[model samples]
Target: MTGRPNDWLLRQLPYGMLSEDFFVRFVSIFQEQAGTLLQHADNLPYLADVDVTPPAMVRHMGEWLGMPGIDTSYPAATQRRILRTAAQTLQWRGTVRGLTHLLELYSGGPVHVTESGGVYREGAAPDDPAWAVLEVDSTGPLSESDFLALVLDEVPAHVQVEVRVAGRTVWPVLAEEGEMAS
Candidate 1:
């Protein structure tokens, strides 16, 4: 005959259990583990919801959205803000409004974005077309090349840009290596 492990144990159990009988024993263990597993499963859907999602998960969400210059060193709130507005930024991508918004978010400061398109003047326009200029404070996380590539990815391929970081201008597409993929 097989002897039960708890045969010699007392009938009553701790933590709200009535008894350590077969029915209660298996159910208690399964119940505890299952509740925890279910909680984790339920949270899977919320991982994409930036405001409520875990801080560490925010980076992965941003990456999944294909946003550039989401620096790992950035604070959790900043990461959340970036991830949250990624869709809005994507909607306005390539426009001056979009570029300015993106750069401001990245720098956590004001940005000036001036593009050459849509200008209507009475006199003849200059023979040489002027590229867009993005002026931002230089205190952000991205290196100059990375920032340049990020901007390039936003604009049309035909449009080149000049970036002035903290009043220092890097003229006419500073991507010595290459532009970052959009």
Candidate 2:
């Protein structure tokens, strides 16, 4: 006589009374359930898929992904973008590209970053002090203090940052018949 298969159903039933067909069916069902559970486990990493995942789950995954600017103050779509691009942004950390990207995100405008005091020479030391000027062309409603704070959070710790809010200036045209007024 054949031995019973190692399964919960087999353990509950008498070994001698079990039929081969019954054991095969039970094993098939167990395999199907295990496959389904494994499939669900495999989908855990894709919890950020907005179509299928809940918003709360996506936010939780964003937290796990350690995305910057993931706070509730930002829109859900913005947070999602940050989480999706977390790896790429981390690769650009401490770089002008990264700072520009961050400033644009926070200020909702174009950003220009310029650095001074790091002039390269043939025999200059690598550890030279540099200052960065961040000129933001902000069309949004962010206040000066808020804009400066946002820039400060993204700039590298070693560089001194000067935040400038730039805007278009229009001067009155001088009349053709008269001299310009001082």
Candidate 3:
């Protein structure tokens, strides 16, 4: 299925079959439908591609990826950008790197994720709960509150995080009906 079609009819057809008029006509009709189906099959991967997928289908892809903060209000371009990094986001869901990657896709700028309680050692005493510092430029497509919500979703619930946007520290926001993030 991954390789080229190498059936005998396609690879080494007999000359006698080519000369039969009825055979040729019947096969031509069959080939027309088969070719169309084959072409669709060949392009099936493009449907999954965030860059080339149709705008209407991109939202469905978001659902398949289980990417949070997706909404119909966000522009198709923003949705694509978020979907493009869904794999990386899912892969690093709970760590600093995962949160950083997802925000970077939205901000298109440098995102800093620094945490203070991750050093491990043998027989070392367990430290108090960890805290994370998330810093990003707020001049991106995402509004500040929406951006913060995404950060909360990616971060572990037990870990306390402080977000600073454009150099101003942001306390936790209790947004009504959590807003959408790109």
Candidate 4:
């Protein structure tokens, strides 16, 4: 049987520092995983009124409300506003941080992160204030296989976590396979 949407979403959580190439792969994987989760969660109730809009200053450049044209209709306007807010809330940084927070909670461990940006360390502490959200830890090295395994094991007993780690994602492992030092 397939895993529940909530369970699947929680398990595909992304964790660890990524190189430039690795980061790109992470983004791709995250989008895929999140898309799947959303698809499975389609039955959930959603507010009818929501819209996204851009600030007037940037209007000259033509802001895309995630569609082809300006949404002037009442429903469209509401959707635009909601979309903008949700977009901001689910920024790349926010999404990554959220995934990290989820990892910590699932692992029942304090995430120690070591990354370039302050965003990675956003709400990380021994006692995370955002318990329900994912936390990013930048302190230590995390292997891709282990990361994938962590996610795979967390899902409810049925669904499989199909993680496709790019060669660049686990460069060290590839290098070792190529007879390079460990």
Every candidate's lDDT: 0.72, 0.62, 0.74, 0.38
Candidate 4 lDDT tens digits, 51-126: 2223331232223422222223424444354344434533332333533453553333464333223234655633
Instruction: In model 3, state the lDDT of residue 42.
Output: 79
Using lDDT as the measure, name the better of candidate 1 and candidate 3. Answer: 3
- Counted clashes in each candidate structure: 0, 0, 0, 20
State model 2's lDDT: 0.62
State, as a TM-score between 0 and 1, how close model 2 is to the true structure: 0.53
Candidate 3's residue-wise lDDT over 1-182, tens digit each? 34655332333447888778787677767666776677689789898778888877888877777765476777888878778787657877787777888788877899988887575778684667888898888737777777777777778888878889888877454356864322
Between candidates 1 and 2, name the one with more favorable TM-score: 1
TM value for model 4:
0.21
Q: Which residue pairs show collisions in model 1?
A: none
What's the TM for model 1?
Answer: 0.69
Q: Which stretches of candidate 3 lie over 4 Å from their true place?
A: 1-45, 73-75, 119-125, 173-182
Clashes of 4: 20
Better of 2 and 3 by lDDT: 3
Query: lDDT of candidate 1 vs native?
Result: 0.72
**Model 2: C-alpha RMSD to truth?**
11.7
Q: How well is each residue in 1-182 modelled by candidate 1, as lDDT tens digits?
A: 12323322323346455544676767667666755666688678886787888877887777777764467787888888888777678878778888888888777689987777766686777666656888998637777887777777877676767778889976564355776423
Tens digits of per-residue lDDT for model 2, 80-140: 6655655457677667887777667666778887886444788774665777877777724
Residue ranges of candidate 2 with Cα displaced over 4 Å: 1-45, 48-53, 57-69, 117-123, 126-128, 139-146, 167-182
- Find the number of clashing residue pairs for candidate 2: 0
